[model samples]
Structures are given as structure tokens and as C-alpha cells.
Target: MEERLQKIIARSGLASRRKAEDMIREGRVSVNSETVRELGFKADIGRDEIRVDGKLICAEETKIYVALNKPRGYVTTLSDPQKRPTVISLLPELGARLFPVGRLDYDSEGLLLMTNDGHFAQQIQHPRFRVSKTYRVKISGRLTGAEFRRLQNGLDLEDGTFVPDAAMIDEINPKSSWLILNISEGRNRVIRRAFEKLGHPVLRLIRTAIADLQLGNLGEGDYRFLKGWEIRQLMSPRRQNERLGKPWEKT
Candidate 1:
């Protein structure tokens, strides 16, 4: 069956549908020997030589989904023009061109979903799917009860407002604090700014979970492939749509 070009790239795990669209627009994606920029273009994955930046994508024997406990300082992109270290640099054995589903900022690290299945990444990362993302954040200062409540409600940032799916203080120390923040929207550097607005600066932000999947015991910079059941859960529409409905759902 024919699928959208973005979908093809996404299913190959090169990136999410939206990011694949960006890659298309940037002339990094091509069909056979021609550059493709239209977002809705389609092709048969088995028959076409779909390439991204001149490298042909090989369809996987089985789509691979991975949960990476990323350590701080790696960029989430497949490759960076600046030659900065990236998430893909950490997994030279993945074989297929999988991509990080959403992203973790260069300095922020935690549970990062890596997959070769673009549609799965799309469903999980797309705002409409309402994927749940949980973060364990360490802040530079103490948070007031009112400030914590404001986070629970939502906070306006330089980009936009962020309404956390759930927000609460997980633990507190005299100099540092830990809070669990769950949100659906994958806004850039959202968690950092949410506390910044309330006079609490984020020191370290690590994602603890994504949807029903937890980061659990995965050491920093370590990763593992997704199991069959986990993949089925991700592909299931009923649960996915249910998670996506709540505006505050975790990403």
C-alpha cells in the first residue's frame, strides 16, 4: 500500500511526521533521485528508493522502539551540521535510521523514545495523539505553594502557555527541589521556563516516563529496544486517543 512520503520516512524512524516534513522542505529528503518537498506526497515503501540526504533508508525487519535514558549534553538530532554530539551518535548499532520521537534539549536528559517506526513516533509525538510525558525536574530554588499551584494550573512562557497534565512537588531539599511534571504538549524547553516564571530556575530536567512506559532503572546514556507488547500499546488507537484528549496529558 502507498503511504505519504512523510509517513514513509517516519515509519523508517528517521523522524516524526512533522520533522520529516521539515526535512522534506529543506531538500534533505528525496524519492528515487528527485527531491520532494510536498507534504502529502506518497510512495510504496517496498518499491521506492527513498533517501534522506542521499542515504537510502532500509525498512526494518521489525520496527524498533527504544527507550533511552539519555545523559545530559547530547543533541537529539540525527546529525548536526555543527558536528555536535547527537542521540544517534550514541547508538551506532541501531542499523536502521531511527530517530528520537520528540527531543531532549542539549542540557536536559531522561527518557527519550527512539524508533524506526515514524507513524508510531507521529502518533506519540503529535499533539492530537496526546502522548503522556513525565519529567523529574530539579530546580535551583524553593517553590512556593502558590507557585506549585500555578504550575498545576498552567503558566505562560516566551513560546506559549503550558498546562501540565499533573504537577506536584516530589521532594524538596534546602538548596534543590524535585518535582514531577507531566505534560502532553512538546513545547521547546517548557519545563525549564515554567519554574523560571515562578522564580525557581531549573537545574536539571530528566524525563521519567512517557505514557504508561516508565524510564525505570535505565542508566544515563543507556538504552534498550522496545518489546512486542510495548509496541502494541503504542500502536493501539483507543488508548492513544484517550491519552491525547486531555489538554494536560503528558507528552
Candidate 2:
């Protein structure tokens, strides 16, 4: 069946669909020896000889889903231009190309999902899905009652409003405080930025869960393939909402 060249490349486990589109625009993808740069171009996956970066494409027979307890200082990318270590380095050779579902900054650590299935990655990463992500954060100082209420209600930041599904103080120290926050938005550096705006800069941040999937007992730098039921829970928005005890109206 004919499909967009980017989709074909993504299904082949070469890259995400968005990355494949970027490859097309950069004139790196070719079809039957002809370079195709248009985003609207389509081709038969079975008939056309699709190649990305000069390698022929074929759909991966086995889709891989992994949950990695990403440690700090590792980039949540397949490759890093600066030569820093990446999450891909921690995984064994599974014989299939896998990419991170979302991102954790170089300094943040915790549960990071990696997958070969482009559709699955898209479903989890896209903000529209409203998949809740919980984080255990350490900030510079304790938040005043008013400040805590603001975070619970929502914060109107320079970019957009960031409203946590839930927010609470986990521990209060003399010099620092710990908090547990749950949010579904995927804005870059959102959690860190939110705390910084409130005069308490984030000292540490660790994502503890994504939807119903927890980082339970997964040692740092260790990775394990997701079970069948876990994959289904992540894929179904209704199921996720049910587990979170919240109703999400599709926008």
C-alpha cells in the first residue's frame, strides 16, 4: 500500500515520523534512486526502494518498547552531537533502531520510554493525548502556602499556563524542599521553569512515573522491555484517564 515516505521510514525504525520529514526536507531520503524532498510525496512501501541516509528501508518485524531508568548526565536522544553519553548507549544491541518517546534534560533523571514503533511514540509524546507525567522535584527552598496554591491551581507563565493535575509537598528541609508534581503538558524545561519563576529554582528533578507506568525498582541506568498490558494502558487514553481518576475531554 502507498503511504507517505516519512511514515514508511518511521515504520522501518529508522527515525520518528517528524525526524523522517526533516530528513526528506534535507534531501537525505530517496525513492528508487531518486531524491524526493517534498513532504507530500508518497510511495509504495513494498514496491519502491526507499532509502534513508543511503540505507534501504524495511518495516521492523518486531516492535520494541522499553522503560529505562535514565540516570542524570545522559541525553535522552539516540545520538548527541557534543559527544555526551545518550540513553541509547545504556541499552544492549536489540537489532532494531529505537528512539526516545519524550525527553529528559541532561540534568534530570528518571523513567524514560524508548520505542521502535513510531505510532506508539507519537501517541505517548503528543500533548493532545494528555498522558500524565509525575515528577519528584527538589527545589531551593520551601514554598509559601500561597506559592503552593498557585502551583496547584496553575501558573500563567511567559509561554503558557502550566496547571498541574496534582501538586504536593513531599519533604521540607531547612535549606531545600521536595515536591511531587503531576502534569500532562510536554513543554521544554517546564517543571524547572515553573519553579524558577516562583523564586525557588529547581535543584533536582526526577520523573517518577509516566501515566500508570512507574519507575518502581528499576535501578538507575537499567532498562527493561514493557509488558503487553503496560503498552495497552499507555496506548489507550481512556484507560490512562481512568487510572489517573480524571476525565480528559478531547480538545
Candidate 3:
């Protein structure tokens, strides 16, 4: 059966669906020795030869899902061009290419999901799913009452409005303060950016959970395969909506 070239590449575990689309547009993907740059191009895996960057791809026989406790200073990518340490270096070679479901900043640490299943990655990362991520952040100073209310009501950032699902002051120190925040959107450095805009500036940030999946005693830099039941719960749309108390509508 014919399938979209990008979908085929993602199913082959070569890259995520989004990355595969970019590869196709860059003219790096070819079908039957002919470079095909059209995003809608399709081919049959069994009959047509499909190659990415000149390497033939085959359907991946096994799908892998992993939960990694990413440590600070490690890049989230499969490989870094500047020879920096990557999250892949912490995992034992499982013989399948696994890409990060989303990303955690290089300076932040915590639970990060990795998978060979492109569909799963796409679903979890898509904003429409509204998967909530919880973070424990240390900011330079405590937030005043007005500032806290602004964060709760939603703050207008240069990019868009950021309203955390939940926010609380955990502790206040002489020089810094700790806060717990939950947000469904995955904007780039959003937590940090929000705090910076509020004049508190994040000093440290660590993701503690994603949906029902928790970091839970998982040692830093350690990785474990996700349980079957956990994967099922994450994939269920009904369960996702239940967690947020409403269906997510894209703005």
C-alpha cells in the first residue's frame, strides 16, 4: 500500500514525522533514484525503493518507547554537531533509532520521552493533545501578589499569552524562591521566558512530570522502557482530555 514518503521515513525510525517533512523539502529524500521534494509524494514500501540522504530505508520491525531522566548540560538531540554530549549517549544501544518526543532545554533536567514510534511522538508533542508538563523552578526572587495573579490569569508575552494550568509558590528563600508550575503548551523556553518577563528570572528549572508519567526516583541520566499500560494511557485521547478537564482547541 502506498503511504506518504515522510510517513514511510518516520515509520522506518530514521526520523520523526516533522523532521522527515523538513528532509523531504530540502530535497534530501529520493524515491526510486529520483529526488522527490513534494511533501505529498507517496510510495509503496514493498515495491518502491525509498532512500533518505541516499540510504535505503526499511520498515522498523520493533517500536521502542523510553523514559529518560535527562541530566543538565546534555543536548536532547540524537547527535550534536559541536560534539556536545547528547541524551542518546546515556542509553544502552537498543539497536533502533529513537528520537526525543519533545525537548528539554540544555540547562534543565528531568523526565523526557523518547520513541521510535512517529505516531506516538506526533500525538504527544502536538498542541491539540494538550499534554500537561509539570516543572519545579527556582527563581531569583519571590513573586509579589500581583505577579502571581498575572501568571494565573495569563501573561502576555511577545510570542503569545502564557497561562499555566497551575502555579504555586513552594518555598521562599532570602535570595531565591521555588515554584511549581504546570503548563500544556510547549513554547520554546516558555517557563524561563515567562519568569524573565516578570522580572524574577528562572535560576533553575526541572521537569517533574509529563501527563501521568512522573520522574519518580528515576536517577539522573538513567533510562527505562515505558510499561505497556503507561503507553496505552498516554495514547488514549479520552484520558488526555480527562486530565485537562476539557478538550483542547487550537487557537
Worst window of 10 by summed lDDT in candidate 1: 242-251
lDDT of 3 at 175: 86
Q: Residue-wise lDDT of candidate 1 within 78-196, one digit each (tens)?
A: 88898888998777586577888998999999889898887888888988878788778899876667677687777888777888776767777779788877778887787887788
Ranking by TM-score: 2, 3, 1
RMSD, each candidate, Å?
11.4, 10.6, 10.9
Clashes of each: 12, 0, 0
Residue 47 displacement in candidate 3 (angstroms): 19
Per-model TM-score versus the true fold = 0.71, 0.73, 0.73
lDDT tens readout by residue for model 3, 1-251 = 99999899998888999999999999999999999999999999989989998899986668899999999999999888899899989988898888999999899999999999999998899998898888989999866777777787888899999988877777777788888888889999999999998999898899998888889999999989999999998998876522433312121
lDDT tens digits, residue span 1-251, model 2 = 89998888888778999999999999999999999999999999769898888998975568999999999999988788999999999999998889999999999999999998999998999988888899999999867777887787778889999887877687888898888888888999999989988999999899999988999999999999999999998898576542333422111
Lowest summed lDDT window (length 10), candidate 2: 242-251
- Model 1: lDDT equals 0.81
List the global CA lDDT of all models: 0.81, 0.87, 0.88
- What ranges in model 3 sit over 4 Å off? 1-60, 241-251
